[model samples]
Target: MSSRLKRGIRRLCSTLSIPLLGCAPAERWEIPHFEPWVPEEFHPASIVPETKTVIVIGMPVSLPAVETSPSIWYHEEYRTVNTLLDINAYRIAAFLNAKGYPSVALPRDGYGHISVLIERPVAFFSHRHAAFLAGLGTFGVNNVLLTPRFGPRVRFTSVFTAAEIPPDPVLEDPLCIRCMRCARICPVHALPGNDYPDGLTDKRACASRSEELLRHYVSPCGFCIKVCPVGDDRKLYDRETMEIYDERKKEFNRLHRAWRHVRNYGGGERAPGMINKTPPG
Candidate 1:
C-alpha cells in the first residue's frame, strides 16, 4: 500500500474514529510462532484467498465499568466495545473495497451464543491472535492479547483486504507481568497460571461460567481483566492501586458501593450475597 493509503487507513482507526488498530501481513500465519499453534484453516488467507493484509481494530472496555464484573454496567460496556469494533471493521473493509481492494470484515465474536463456546470453544477467527500479529499487542498470561493502552480490556475485530498494506512489526518485548492475578481470580479456575500457549484457559469451564453469567445478562465475567494492572488506562482513571479491587479494604468501600449499586438493577437476579454485600441503607 502507498504511504498515503496507509495514512488513510490509520486515520480511519484513529481515536476520533475506531480507537486502537494495527495491520498484519496475511503471510504471518505461516511463521514458526503461529504455524504450530494456529491451524491453517484459521489463517486469513484461508478465509479470504485474496487477502494480502489483515487490519485489526480495537475498542476498550472501561476499567471502572469492567471492575464491576458480572454486573450489568460492565456487561453493557463489553457489548458496546464489541459493537464498536465490529462496526469499525466493517467501515474499514468498505474503505478498502472502495480503494479497489477486495475486503471482508470479520465478526467480533463468531459464536452464536455463549452456549456454543461451552461445546466448541474455538471461533472461526481469533481477533486476539490477529491483534498480536498486527503489532497491536502481545499475549498475556490470561491468553488474551494485552495492548499497552488497554491491556486485555479491549475487544478487537479484523478486516481482510487484497491490498498489500505494509504490516506493523510484532512487539518483541512481552507484555504479561505474569502476576498470576488472572489465573487466581478466575472464579471457575479456568486459567492454569502458565504462560500463554502453555497455560491456555480451560475453555469449557470458562464458557460454562460465561453461560451462567449470560443468563443473568452479565455473561463475560471479566474478573481477570478487571484485576489486571496493565494498561495506561489504570493511570488515566486514577485506579493505579490494585487494592481497590479488594472488597475488604474499607477505604475503597465507596467505589465498591457504587459498583454494587449498578449490579442491583437492570439484570437478572443473583442468589443472596452472590454479588456485593448490601450497601449501607
Candidate 2:
C-alpha cells in the first residue's frame, strides 16, 4: 500500500476504535495451527492468489455500563448502541460486497461457524485476530480486542474469502508497556495472571461468571472499557471518577431499597392533590 493510502486506512480504523497499530506488518503475530474439528468446503479454484479479496469486519456490542438503571431510558440507549453496531458492521460488509468481494457477517453468538473461540487452541487464528491481521486493531490486556475508537467496548464479527489480497502487516506499540488496568477492571478476572509469556486465560471461568452476572440483567460487563487508558475522551473514564461513581451507585441502591420498604409498610399518606389530580382549568 502507498504510504498515503496506509495512513488513510489507519485513520479510518482508528476512528472506529480499532487499533491499526497492532496490525502493522512489522508486528504481525504468527497464528498457531490446529486440526479442524469439522471440515468445511475449501475451493482452491476459487482462490485468487493475486486478486486481493476477503475483508473481515468487527461488530460492536452494547457495553454493560448503564445496565444498572431501571429506567426505560437506559433500555432505549442500549438499543441505540446495538443498532449503531449493527449498522457499522453491515456498512463494511456492503462496502466489500460492492467491491466484488463476497462478504458475510460472522455471527457473534460465540459458536457460529466462524465464531471467535477464545478458549480453543485455534483462538489465536480467530476472526478478531484475522481482523488484527487485516490491520484493524490490536489486542488489549483484557484478552478482548481494543480499537483506537472503541477501546474494548466492542465485540467482533468477520468475513472471509479466497482472494489474493495484500495482507496488512501488524503494527506494534512500544508504549503499551503491558499495563494491567484492563485485567483489574474485568468483573470476572478473565485476563491472565501477571506472569506468563503466552498469557492465556481461564475462559470457562470467565464465561460462567459473565453468564451469572447477565442473569442479574447486566448483559456485558464493560469494566474493561472503564479501565483502558487509550482512546478518545468519550469512551475513556478516569479511574478515580469511576470509583466514585461506583460508591455513589451503592449508596443510591441502599436508599432506594429503604424507600421501597417505607412506601410499602409505613402509614404515610399521599400529599393533598397528589393521589388523583387533574389539570387546572
Candidate 3:
C-alpha cells in the first residue's frame, strides 16, 4: 500500500472514533516467539490465505468507567466499545476492498456467550496477540495486552488484507511493570501472578465469575485491568493512586458511593447474597 493510502486508513480509524491503530505482516505470526505459542490454524494466512497485512485497531475503555466494573455502567461501556470495534474494522476492510485489495474484518470477540467461555475459554482468533505483534502493546502478567496508552483497559479488533501495508515495528521493551496488582486483586483468584505463558489466567474460574455476573446483567469482571497502574490514561484521569480502589478507605467513600449507586439501578437486583455488592479492591 502507498504511504498516502496508509495515512488515509489511519485517518479513517480516527474518524470512526478509534484512537489506536497498527499494522503487522501476516508472517509475523510464524516468528520464533509466536510460532510455538500460537498454533498454525490460528494464523492470519491460514484463515485468509490472501492476507499480507494484519491491521489492528483499538479503543480505550475509559478508566473511570472501568473502575465501576461489574456494574451496569462498565457493562454498557464494554458492549459499546466492542460494537464500535466491529463496525470500525468492517469499514476499514471495506475501504481496502474498494481499492481492489481482498480484505476481511474479524469480530472483536468470537465466542457466542459467557457460558460458552466457561466451557471453553479460547477464541478462534486472539486480538490480544495481534495487538502485541502490531506494536500496540505487550502481554501483561494478567495475560492481556498492556498498552502504554490504556494499560489493559483497551479492546482490540483486526482486519486482514491482501494489500501489504507497511508494518509497525515490534515493541522491543515490555510495557507491564509486574506489580502483581492484577493477580492480588482478582476476586476469583484467576491470575497466577506470573508473567505471560507461565501465568496464564485460570480461564475456567474467570469465566465462571463472568457467567454468574451475566445473570445479573453485568459480566466480564475487569478487576485486573482496573488495578493495573500502566498507561498514560492513569495520569490523564488523575488515578495514579491505588488507594482509591480500596472502598474501606474513608477518603474515597464519595467515589465508592457513586459506584454503588450505579450498580444498584441497572441489572437484576442483587438478592441478599447473589454476588458481592462491594467492588473488588
TM-score of each: 0.94, 0.54, 0.95
Candidate 3 structure, TM-score to reference: 0.95
Model 3 Cα lDDT, one tens digit per residue, 131-243: 98999999999999999889999999999999989889989899899999899888889998998888889999999988888888877689899999999999998888787
Misplaced by over 4 Å in model 1 are 245-252, 268-270, 277-281
Residue-level lDDT tens digits of model 1 in 23-101: 8999999898688778999999999899999888888899878887778888888888888777878888898889898
Kindly report which residue stretches of model 3 are placed more than 4 angstroms away from their true locations once superposed: 245-254, 271-279
In the predicted model 1, the residue pairs found to clash are: none
Output the lDDT of residue 159, model 1: 92
With a 3 Å backbone cut-off (N, CA, C), the pairs that clash in candidate 3 are: none
Distance (Å) between predicted and true CA of 27, model 1? 0.6
Best by TM-score: 3
Query: Worst ten-residue run, lDDT, model 3?
Result: 271-280
Give the lDDT of residue 207 in candidate 3.
91
Cα misplacement distance, residue 92 of candidate 3 (Å): 0.3
Better of 2 and 3 by lDDT: 3
Residue range 1-281, candidate 2, lDDT tens digits: 33443354346556766432222221122223311311222111123222233345444433333322222233345545555445655655455567555544433343422213324423312555545555556665666556666555555544343223446545455223366875665555677745222566567666564444334333333445545555443344332223322354444232133322232221212222321121100
